[model samples]
Target chain A: MHGYTANKDDILKRLRRIEGQVRGLQRLVDEDTYCIDVLTQVSATTKALQSFGLTMLEDHLYSCVADAIAEGGDGARDKVQEASQAIARMVRT
Target chain B: MHGYTANKDDILKRLRRIEGQVRGLQRLVDEDTYCIDVLTQVSATTKALQSFGLTMLEDHLYSCVADAIAEGGDGARDKVQEASQAIARMVRT
Candidate 1:
């Protein structure tokens, strides 16, 4: 099981909603919606995607990262480093 | 015609690609992919959405906003303020 295994359905639901948001964006463009309106929708979609990422990060930290650290080994250090890099990518994006 | 009218096709294409990215994320989660790997994909998808928003904002500034400012009246001020608010929403998200 992965770090998010316990809440797999919830995660999938969030992703599905985000997928719908992307589809909505296409529909807006298809209808020649105003630029500012379309941009506003885009911002909303981006925020949803970012929120999903944050939830996943939190789950990972609470489960896999915590487990590794509790065991006290090189794996724990590596996991923390890897997680930090992932956070950096999210922030930069 | 809106600011993005000239490149409507391109915008739609980008949104389609982003939709695919979101679907891929679902597949990864379905397969119980590692948390870090999933988070990385999430970041990539978020960046793509943000980039799409920026492109729309640029087009708006070039066309609609520019036209208002050239007219030089209350409309110009209103357009600038509206655009500024849109930018704030994007950044805050």
Candidate 2:
């Protein structure tokens, strides 16, 4: 199983809260809120997603990647590669 | 500036490493690595992205969201909504 299984509930809860926040944003846009105000909200949302992604990465490194490294051989290499790709994508965003 | 600006360089550096990892994955696939092995790499990549997202979220909450809330009124509400949407999108992924 994936390492995230350990904290899946907590993660999901956080996601749900974030979903609500998005809905609120839509409302603000609908109401014709100020441009800077909307942009600020957008900035907040982007940060939140990035933060969530980082937390997950830490868990993966500590749990999944660590396990792979302990196992050694191709497993270790693959895990490292996987992690690197994940990081690259995050940065691009 | 976004809260992540402080750590943008670090984040980008990490991302560059991840990008290399992804390239490795493509190579693995090209070499016909085992199916389970590839799957494992995929899983790792996903987790890493999620983790990255979470990190950004934390920064947003601490900096941008906090600032908006401190300012009060519509700003606070808008920030909250934006955060919620970001979380929701992350979870959906």
Candidate 3:
């Protein structure tokens, strides 16, 4: 079972809301919204998205990576290695 | 200069502080601190770390990956492809 299983719907819903927030911010630009206000909202939206992203990453590592580590086969080894690179990308970024 | 150039140190410092915050949270647990308070602080720290990670990712896409894409070579193609996987990991997380 995936760790993301429990809150998958909730996370997707939140991301959709954020996507709408971003589109609204873009429209604000088209309509010349106040720079500070738009920027403020952008910052908030960015933080929200990042929070969401982190939750998914944490779950992936805890569940998928740990499972791969425990399984110990050719496929499992590949999976674990790929997960490492994924993690390096996440934190290196 | 790198994409992480301008704020590299600052970001690292923030991460270090967050690490400290995490340790503090552990201590809170050890000391039997209020569950809600510890959880709240943990959430904040996680969000902060994620936000920082996003900044670095954005910069990498804008500068490093873009540069690799703009150039032409086996190395450049490999770099861009690797970056794609990295971004996929970030969002697919």
**Which candidate leads in DockQ?**
1
Per-residue error for B78 in candidate 2, Å, reads: 22
Order the candidates by TM-score, highest first — what do you get? 1, 2, 3
Residue B60, model 1: Cα distance from true site in angstroms: 0.5
DockQ for candidate 1: 0.89
Chain B TM, per prediction = 0.97, 0.94, 0.75
Predicted complex 1: CAPRI docking category? high
Which structure among the candidates has the greatest lDDT?
Answer: 1
Better of 2 and 3 by DockQ: 2
What is the TM-score of each predicted model, taking all chains together? 0.98, 0.51, 0.45
- What candidate 3 gets wrong by more than 4 Å, as runs, is A1-93, B73-77
Q: How close is candidate 2 to the true structure, as a TM-score?
A: 0.51
How large a fraction of the reference contact set does each model reproduce?
0.94, 0.00, 0.00
lDDT string for model 2 (B1-93, tens) is: 766667666655644544444455455445545433544554454455456567767877888889999999999998888888777766655
Chain A TM-score, candidate 1? 0.97
Clashes of 3: 0
RMSD of each: 0.8, 12.7, 16.8
Q: What is each candidate's DockQ, to 2 decimals?
A: 0.89, 0.04, 0.03
